[model samples]
Target: MRTLFSKCLVAPALFASTLASAEVKLPFTLDWKFEGPSAPYFLAVDNGHFADQDLSVEISAGQGSLDAIPKVATGAYPVGFADINSLVKFLDQNPGAPVTAVMMIYDKPPFAVVGRKSQGISTVADLEGSVLGAPPPDGAWAQFPVFAKENGLDMSKIKVEPVGFPTREPMLAEGKVDSVTGFSFSSYLNLVRLGVPEEDLTTLLMADYGLALYGNAIIVNTDYAEKNPEVITGFLTAVAEGVKDAAADPMAGAQAVIDRNPAGNVELEAWRLKLALQDSILTDYVMANGLGDIDVERFEKALEQIAVTYEFKGEPSVSTIFTDAYLPASELLMMK
Candidate 1:
């Protein structure tokens, strides 16, 4: 990881002779498990992408993407990554949580329905009236019904079966459910790794069906961004660079993550991550535009729907739900 950034840096002696540097501290509340898809965030730290912009960051795990929003709003973390749905809920429930979005991370939402070709199921339409598998607690299938209406899907027609977590891959192979709902980056790729031929499987993207909403995002407290705008901007700039690097070379990023772990399945995690990058939408969507990028207009559409679902009681617009000052970096990183 150090080697990568060093390749891009100007010679130290010349840079030192000409420039001035300042140190800044920042805290990040991670949106996923350590060394998973969030590996790029670790890459950003290990490779000094944060340091290049005079920002230093401390990263800690978050239970779910949704959980990060409240933590950032409360100042437990100056900035964090989260899903679009939860942040909207937080704003409606608390009315005082000052969270806002930084950038849109996954251009194509990661939601998908997977089925084995051998099972004779090959499309989202096939799941109509068919049994569908879901990860019990946070399974994408359970998230399906609430998000389904937006996609023009008839969620009531489908039978949802609660499947154990981390078992979707094999269960699909064994014909447990006709299809399973999950993120392509995590669960689906696990199936591919276990020798499920891509040609023998069908993946139907939920986003194509109108379930299009931002999945991962970088978030910060609106108050902190208002006061220390530059620091937030620099922090996101570094994070974006890290996202870019991860896309260009996931192996390096995965290795960087593996290098950080002290014990327990380092190699297994690394291999799985590499497979995830190869088959996941993460690289194709997020790589080109940079990471943590959010579209307000797109977000507003989903936010309105969720607020109505949760009975926000007609509170307010989602425009104030997030801030982009940090991730866009339209100013500071470009300025002298």
Candidate 2:
């Protein structure tokens, strides 16, 4: 009888050892630097969500939303976070790239035209005659034409200054540019930190103004996804759990980011995380339907909107762009 009990204990330990040995290393790339919006991914690592799925995830920060598509397409990184709209353009240009979005993260994209009210720019129409600072590779800048077209703004009248990402916010703060294109939560909070009053800022979120675009999503190298189907599902399941936990305790999520970024302020990051949760992540559609999935109708409409500005080399299809086959059952994806 003693031997039987000993065998039971040893069996559990052996299983654990085997599971640990079977863990796969997945390198993940993010759409941007370590900030409040990126806390959930870090939380996934810190909270053992990835470990629970037998994945060892190493996260690296990216320069912009467009940065990770090629990295994942080339199979350099198995998975990455990036703008879905940019992915559409990339596949259209590259034609048969091995990368596609697997999960929808930002239901309501944070793209916006952020301007100072004091600079006589309180509305979208105010942008017509203003000097707009836009980074060439920015996802928001890429979508600006669609926003302008929907709002009936004449682009020819607007003075566009091509600014680098580092100088984007500062140029607006220093009055060099009246407005800039960027993610709403990121630009708004950055300007606040730079001594710009909250009231002085006018953030015209494109979604609020008739843009039907979705935002960043979890993208994967299709070749990698095909070879390891279970790994893709497990990675997404862990990501869903991480997003849920981060939404539940935003301060904890912010701490995870701060731990990774020693220079990050916990208070600021917490505030930023909350803004993302409210503005982009936990939208009405997402809260009702759960995370990591998209409404087919909405996604199709978004594609039509993307076509407004970009001249596609070939027709884009929903199936080629995203697939929910690797997502866990819907029950596990519920945030609230």
Candidate 3:
């Protein structure tokens, strides 16, 4: 009995040592704080998806969507989650920065103008005469110009209140602002958390109102990816697995987030995760074509729409901004 017990202990220790030695350390940066949307990556870590790929990924929270672009470009992080539209402008400005989106996570895009019905902001037209609270650095705010132009909203009539992320929802809740530009999932839930009734909240998702732009994606350091192509492929495979597992049981994903951020309310975050999965991540196209891939023609049209509001030094190409080269098989990307 003593001999058998000692052998079992020795075997586990040896296996653990092998795992530690073989694991590839890859630090990943996120577009925002540890929240419901961030749960899948945490699930991947907790569920050993990354381990299955021989990767040891450490996730770091970012200031905003644009924050991770420079981080990965500078090689501070080999992988990151960020807004792909922001990446288009970043690449255009930087010229040759070694960063590109490897996977498409937010297929429908979450950009929206969230307002309180009590504040007289029930529709897009209501925004013209009201105060719209917007964080200058927010990904949703960045695309508001296109939304306004598409809906024939005259910017001159709208009162633009530049508020910080922390103050955005509070200001809206306090009736200091008529509306706010933010992600549909984030802002709606934030308001609900602050004691606003669901019926009182009016969400005008940009994607629903003529905006065809894609949303956040997993970006990779091109320099690193070139040398470690297999690592990139493996990393994406693990991420897909995480997304599939999380979608099947969203509460599990929410638990993973709460485990990391104990301050978060599990029920609220679980709802947020569900919103992101149902409204943003899993779309008709993603369901049919599988995840991590984009329609090239639609993407080109999105760039054209962006050009209407943003001046470019050079033309942006879909190939340069995003690639499926690092994506896993179609079967792997299909959500369960």
Candidate 4:
């Protein structure tokens, strides 16, 4: 009886060891704080999507869209979410930073110049002589020049104020600045939280004005991706599932985010998640081509648009910056 019991214990221990070895530890970095858009990922965690792919993913909040680019480039984290345009410039400066976008989110690109309707910023032309608060590292600010140029606004006429991310909205609410550069979903909701009426906000979406730009994407360290292609694929697969789940039931996704961030307002964050889904994530192209893919032709035009504002050290190739080789099947990626 003692020998039989010992044998059972050995089998269970080995099984435990196998489970531990089989699970790949992957830490994911996000572009911003825990908010509505982040819900899908939390839902993925709650639903065991990562575990289904034999991955143990840990998602951490970020400071801004540009924050996670270097984290992944340095191999400090294997995968990260960041602005793809920022990645383009980083690659241009670093020459070979080992970071490239694998999955495209924010298909419509949330970069926008948000102004208060009551502050004489109802039109893009209104920014010509108004105070514009801009965060230096903000993804929207990074693309503001393009937005300005496309809209035929003289940037020289626009009075720019450099502000911290935390103060960007507050300053606007207090009438410190007439306008601000930020993501549409983020800035719009932020002002709402600051007691600004929804009707008083004027969101000048860059994409609507003629900037053919892509937004944030899942970026990976090339070295890490090369060594662990399967892991990258699994991570993306799990993320796609998360996005789908979020789209299906945004409220549930918001609940997932609220679970991790108790301070967040569930109703507001749910609406925010819904805003991201409708305005940025689930676009006509995304819905038609399925998620985790991009139109090469449109991407090329976007690269050309970026080149207008940014000088590239080495020639940038669309294929080099992004790849769909690791994407799951269309059925798995289709959000609909």
Evaluated against the true structure, the overall lDDT of model 2 is: 0.92
- Give each model's whole-structure lDDT: 0.68, 0.92, 0.91, 0.89
Residue-pair clash count for candidate 2: 0
Ranking by lDDT: 2, 3, 4, 1
Residue 333 miss distance in model 2 (angstroms): 1.5
**Candidate 4 clashes between residue pairs 3 or more apart in a chain or in different chains:** none
* Candidate RMSDs in order: 7.4, 2.5, 3.1, 2.4
Clashing pairs in 2: none
TM-score of predicted structure 2: 0.92
lDDT of 4 by residue, 174-293 (tens): 999999998888899999999999999999888889988888899999999999999999888898999989988888999999888899899999989988898889998888888888
Q: What's the TM-score of every candidate structure? A: 0.80, 0.92, 0.91, 0.91
lDDT of 3 by residue, 1-336 (tens): 579889998999999898789989999999888889888899999999999999999999998777899999999999999988899999999988899999999998999999989989898999978999999978789889988999999999999999999999999999999999988998999898899999999999999888889999999999999999999999999998888888988999999999988998889889999999988998888888898999998899899888977899997888899999989888888875
Q: Cα lDDT for residue 135, model 2?
A: 97
Model 1 misplaced stretches (Cα beyond 4 Å): 1-22, 146-153, 193-195, 262-293, 304-309, 328-336
| Candidate that beats the other on lDDT, 1 or 2, i.e. the better one | 2
lDDT of 3: 0.91
Model 2: per-residue Cα lDDT over 65-121, one tens digit each: 667999999999999999999999999999899999999999999998999999989
Query: Is candidate 1 or 3 superior in TM-score?
Result: 3
